[model samples]
Target: MALLDFLRQKEFAEISALKNKLALLEKDIEIFREREDRLNHDILSLRNERDKLLKYKDVSDVDNEKERIIKELKDAKEELQKEELESKDNIEKLKKEAEELLEEIENKKKQVVELDNTILLQDYGMYSPVYDFADSEMYKDRLDAIRTEQKNMILYKTAATCSTNWTLNGSEAQGRVMTNQNIKQILRCFNDECDMLISKVKFNNATAFIEKIRKSYDALNKMNSKNAVSISYEYLELKVQELQLAYEYAQKKQEEKEEQRRIREQMREEARLQKEIEEARKDIEKEQKHYMNALLKLDKQLGECDEVEKEVLLEKKSEIERHLSDLDIAIKDIDYREANKRAGYVYIISNIGSFGENVYKIGMTRRLDPMERVDELGDASVPFKFDVHAMIFSDDAPTLETALHHAFENKKVNMINGRREFFNVTLEEIEEVVKANYDKTVEFVQIPQAEQYRESQKILKSLEIS
Candidate 1:
């Protein structure tokens, strides 16, 4: 029995130990379960907060909201990309427009520059024509013609260069409207220059007239202006050529006129010489007839008269015979014919008050009475009446005149033309030359009978005193 009780006590101790271990395990289990419940609650709260923050009222709405938000973000990004592309295109368009505008501005500038250069070239080409001439009475008509032509040319050129239309009615019009202002200014300058040139063209002959025109035109050609005529070089050259041709024509016309005048003067001189020769021949024939008749009458008177009267008649007959011999010689020497004529008388005369001492006119006369020629010479042509120096008859009057002219050729007032008969010689010197040439005595009057001239001089002196 003792052995059985010891074994049971050991068993009871083992069972109590087992029950205490179980109780401890049960308490630990409760603690673990409480912790698990807290962890679960915290996790639910976090999930709810996440859904609300995502703009969803419930868990089912969370996924749809997320999808909508993501889609919205994607659409916004695409729209931003589209806007960026459009901005880039706009930038490119603006850049292109700016380049085009700049090119247009450059082209306009080039056109303006070109236009200015053209205007400058036009302004550089304005000019005028020239003329020249000489001064002389022979060119009087030619000078007048040239002056008229110059004026006409200037008017024409002015019109051409300025494009101004003029009429006799004092009306004006523009020819070309494009350059009207420039043309008007050019016309004003041209007219002013032409007026000045015309005023200065006071010439009496062709040469002087042409010279003045040439000088004036040269001055005009050198003139400059900001707005000048736009005449081409070819046109200007043609105008100058025309002007030269006109000048040449004027000169040729003047030369022809002078030649005609010279020919007329020569014809007149020849006619005068022939007429004088014929008259001289007739006078010689008349004198020969009268002397022969006187000789025959004197011979008959000598035979009928008494001794004293016969002697006087014989002397008269002898004188008549000598005159007849002289007449015969004169007639033969004259050898007058229709083809071969005789020369007349060579006369010397002077007007002392009008022409100083030693001044005499030696000339020929073909009149029947030589004194008639001297009287004719003393007419209204001279200031004073001429004094008769010598009236010398000669069969060869031209030869005698030539001899006298040669003797006083050195003393001639006009040396160029020997026809001018005035000579610086004394009356005594002329008488000696006449006596040496002719056998007959020549009567010379030393004093001038200036009746009209002296009276005029006296009147003039009284007027001066008054």
Candidate 2:
């Protein structure tokens, strides 16, 4: 219905209306995509160029000379005994610094791909694929045999997007073992708003969802997950009770001190001998003084943790709400299958670095559209018209997709289909990444075997409950 309505809302006749708007956005996406490709080319070229440019001036080859110098340095150091130490001491700092700088530069170069990918995603949303898909329905009726032609058909309508209700409550998807910080990062994706919003989704593909998880984890590894994870509300509530109790104690002490001060002031003028202080009065006063001091000290002690506690929980209701909102957004359904297309061959590729036979090349694209993806990544995506390495499709379509699963990780999550629901990744997320990344490979290896029956029987005889 949204697809139909959206198409109706647009005026296809106008050049600069909705259609134009979508087209322009696509154009922009294309430019970024092309730019990304150019940048990648530049990076590759620079990598090769740097290798050649490592020559030191006046030396035949800086690398060779350095090797010679290193050998001589090693021999001389052996002779001096302390030479090795001096060499290590002299170069370790420099080596460490060089490595760090190199990493920084590599990060900078790679950033172009990241930003370009983001831009491509924005483009998909602008030119939503819903309309395109809806326009692809091919009409058909009873067909004819070779002997007698039955009928002919050439009607077309667009495809439909799958829909689901929004009854997302945070607790259902609540994950365990996730830290407070991990949850916050996932929450940020939902708009950085301070409110709890939770939504459930039906993912299209489990593999794609896992891919998303891998990507998200890599992006937010340094972020703290503890904050987002819900501690025992019971425990926190208990802590609150403790806080309130301390607060009460402090207030009572403060009041008691005030009263004692008044009493002491009232008795100040009378001479020590003339005013024979009642033993009871003195005892009461002494008790009041001792308690007052103790209370003050306790107040300060509790005060020490005030900020830390507040931060841990301040507007926590609000924080949890914000996290829920993030979850809702993270679980949005891309459902690329809904998109209708005019295509020759389509290859949806993930990290193909390790899948050699399954992979054509290690290529990266900043765009999601097959056409723009082709233009951006160059030959790998569309090496030759008919020779498409692997025709593939992705679950995320119309709108660009990102890996929020990785962004959230194993705090607690239920990945239904290709969508993430019920939990945040605030725990040992990397392990989850590795687990998910190779999920496919692992599944193939772990399938139960027929020979395992004999092995199982032997194990049972050894000490098993058969």
Candidate 3:
């Protein structure tokens, strides 16, 4: 029984220890459950907070809320990406527009520059004549008539001078007097400006002067706006006409003087040619008589002489006959020249020192000796003697010259004046034109001698070396 009590006590001790371990485990499980409950509450509170932050409406549908939030975020991201692409496109478009605008501005700047440099009117020097008067005297008469009419208009208080009638001290007479004085002063100012511009007007600056006068009219009217005093448009037109007529009149006078000088030169040249032809005829006649007398003497000597002397006399007779034939031909040529006024030598010549290479003066002269005319041409007027390219005898020299001039009309050195017969053309070109127009085969001196010019150049070179 003692042994059974010991075993039972041991058993009771083991059961009591096991019961304590169970109580400790129960307390730990209770603490764990409380922790799990607190954790679950925290998770719920966090989920609620997350829903509020995400603006999720259904708290009970947590998974649906999460899915909806995720989908919304993806949609927002896609929208942001699309907007980013659009923004990039817009930036490129704006860049292109800005570049185009800058190019247009540059083009406008270039246009302004070009306009500033360009001439407003292309017909600068070739001004059209305003008056069709026969002479400068007629132009002067017209100008006098215009001036007299203008003066009469002003004196009679016509439309030439205008003004508004204003009351001065309530007297009509006083108002009239003031208006007259104002009109006079305005007329004087405008006339002075117009006269100044007209005086300065020329072929090149006519356009500028016209603009200035119109501007002056506008400015004077603006300045006298209160008085309403201004020059009439009819008077303005008359003034413009006067300016043009005056310039053209002066030009006409100059042209008339040149024409008169040319006429005098032509008369002198004609007189000289007559004298030369008469002298040449007389010389030929005298030479023919001398040759005839020599032939008669040789014929007498041939009748009396022996074989050797007879042969010499016959030879001398033949030479004398030949001489007489040449003299007769020269007399006939002189007679023809004197009879035919249009018969002359058309010469092509060049002065390389005066003009340049390929420049030729094609002219006609009725001189008995055409070389004399060429020599006269190469006289003191030119720096060097002219080299003759061709000297052609034409029945109607003027017509042939006119034909050549018409052929090379655009190749003239002085295009404005048809009288200046110098042409800038190649020898081949001139030959071609001459062959085409003239029936006769012409020989052209393709190479110029230019002897004096070449010598002068050599001298200059030597001087420079020294």
Provide the TM-score for each candidate, comma-separated: 0.37, 0.17, 0.69
- lDDT rank, highest first? 3, 1, 2
Tens-digit per-residue lDDT, 74-135, candidate 3: 56555545655554565555556545555554543322211111353453765677778999
Candidate that scores best on TM-score? 3
* Error in Å for residue 176 of model 2: 8.5
Q: Looking at model 2, report the run of 10 residues with the lowest lDDT sum.
A: 153-162
- What shift in Å separates residue 444 of candidate 1 from its native position after superposition? 8.8
Candidate lDDT (C-alpha), each: 0.58, 0.34, 0.74
Could you list the CA RMSD of all candidates, in the order they appear?
45.4, 43.0, 30.8
lDDT of candidate 2 over 216-280, digit per residue (tens): 33444324222322222232222222223333343344545666775674344222212322342
Which residue ranges in model 1 land beyond 4 Å of their true spot? 1-211, 222-224, 228-323, 336-374, 388-466
- Between candidates 1 and 3, the one scoring higher on lDDT is 3
